[model samples]
Target: MEISGYIALAVMGITLGLVGAGGSILTIPILVYLLQVPITLATSYSLVVVGSTAFIGLLRYRDHILFRKAILFLIPSALGVFAARRFIVPTLSNILGHLLLGQVLVILLIIFMGIAGYFMIKRPILDIQNHSHKKQNIKKSKVVLIGLALGIIMGLLGAGGGFLIIPTLVLLMHFAMREAVATSLFIIAINSFIGFVTNQSQFIASDWGNLKKYLTPSLLGMLIGLYIVKFINGEILKKSFGYFIWVVGIAILTKEFIL
Candidate 1:
């Protein structure tokens, strides 16, 4: 609504465009710390904004995506979302009030992002041509198992799982970085959409008005971010982005733990 809000929205959009997966990590913190939105409402708003932005990016880059490979991953991933949303999340939310649960969720997300970041930085270089050999060696069961695990994390945390998904696709399944990124977007979109729907009733009943105020600014930022993606070196920026997430996570945890 104000110039500061517009600036924040632009910053978030640029972050998403620069690094595809970390937009919500930035969005949530901006909403909570800067805008003074409650953690529960911020998380809900982050999901809708991030999901819509990801959907737009996916559409713009649809031709670059590997559809067949994405489907292979999405089927089990969707089932995992259903299980987590219908069974796991509701059970957790009932036991933990939304605000407390959001704090707990952010803690877990920090841990998850830390691990993903470590692997992204330390992973060994592989020859893409030899990937077929690696793929043949991976059992189908293991892939599904990993997919289910990632799906549950994505559903529970409201993350697109790009941090986890990209590495898994590349190292475990032997996809190239470009393909992995494209596939990761698809998986994130599917998982995020399902996660948002699962929590929609609560969001609708609470702060839908404030949520709507964020949509246009978020979408504008996302478009700018996507355009930047065309010119940027994503790999070089990932570690820096990870550090940014680490800082935000610590600040959020401290805020929740203290005042």
Candidate 2:
């Protein structure tokens, strides 16, 4: 590939390392704007790449991840992903296909990223100090609800769902931020895989050359990111990452709106 392509791949890796979900948000833009892949194809490709990377990361952190809780969350999310992929995304994409659909997808991507960015910056005050007893009482229900909600978003938008999952775990479920991040990666991996499987037919029809080009570099970057997670102060970095997301989202939105 060219220098620019390598640069973009490196950027993607660094972004994922610094902030878990940014890779999904940036994947479509890189494929479409930089590599000239069609938007629909780009979205599918992004899901495959992000899902694969998240799966690898989750595997590395499996020992630390809370499996019982993760499974509880995954069940509802799996159901949600099935429902959305079977009923929602195809319907919406069909309706919007003619009206600059690529632009519309880009706009939606930006909106989601912007919301994620804002949440990152705000860093909701989590009260985990004395909620141990309360957590046991309501944790299952909260995990299921969050999983369903996150799954719907993932199915609809091709997102990895880390943005929603991490916050939900940390703020409402009262998990430590680090554990939440680890858990979110697992959830994102599962949901993204399910969502991609739901759209397998369409993907098979598309030209997937760019995705091939992306695999090695993206995986290398993800490995680097996983390694970095061990040493970083995630909370502070997450806040700064939010600012970065805001800038990228606005820039993408502006480009779509104006040109």
Candidate 3:
């Protein structure tokens, strides 16, 4: 792997530590474009990288995790991820003529990176404070649908879905910001790992040696991020990273579609 790849991985971990939700978004592109991993394999690698990092990132906010909520969310999510990886990805691979499945996945990933970038830059604060009491009363069906949708997205794009999950937890679930971020990590970890494990062939075939190269720096960055969070202004950092995501997304778009 190039030195740039290692630096990106560390930055990814640091982003996760700082924001708790957006860092793992960079994993796929980094693996594919920088580290020269095959795109399909990159998705699987993303699951490991994001899932493991998220699992580690959540340790700091363990007290804020809502296990019951995480469990409830996991059921549909796990099934959705399993379905996407086990069926949808393969089906798309075989059926899509001319357009490679890897290309399709990269396009989807770019679109999502744009969305994630928007969320990070805008950083809108939903006024759900008045709805605190009703948070628990949110319909179960809604949760299932949301979970299923997010799971499919995660499975398809190899993203942790933190950008989507955090907002869903905060606005719809009415969780506190701290709780939402923490629980987002928990959900991301399970969803990502479920996607990872579902692709058994990829799991077995993956280049573990290469994968470890990316993981080491990211984990170290996560620790650095945890410590840095205390000193930095989170909003400013988030906005800065959000713009960076857009720049990366544009570069991806150019590489994949235009150039």
- How many clashes in each structure? 2, 0, 0
- RMSD list, candidates in order: 3.3, 3.2, 2.3
The 0-to-1 C-alpha lDDT of every candidate, in the order given, reads 0.69, 0.72, 0.83
Off by over 4 Å in 2: 1-6, 98-100, 124-143, 229-236
The CA root-mean-square deviation of candidate 2, after full C-alpha superposition on the true structure, stands at: 3.2
- For this target, which candidate reaches the highest lDDT against the unseen true structure? 3
lDDT of 2 at 41: 69
After superposing candidate 3, which stretches have Cα over 4 Å from the reference? 97-99, 126-138, 204-206
Model 2 whole-model lDDT (C-alpha atoms): 0.72
Order the candidates by lDDT, highest first.
3, 2, 1
Among all windows of 10 consecutive residues in model 1, the one with the lowest summed lDDT is 120-129
Q: List TM-scores for all candidates, in order.
A: 0.82, 0.83, 0.92
- In model 3, state the lDDT of residue 194: 83
Error at 240, model 1, angstroms? 1.7
Model 3: lowest-lDDT 10 consecutive positions: 126-135
Off by over 4 Å in 1: 1-6, 119-136
In model 1, residue pairs whose N, Cα or C atoms come closer than 3 Å (at least 3 residues apart or on different chains), thus clashing, are 13-221, 17-225
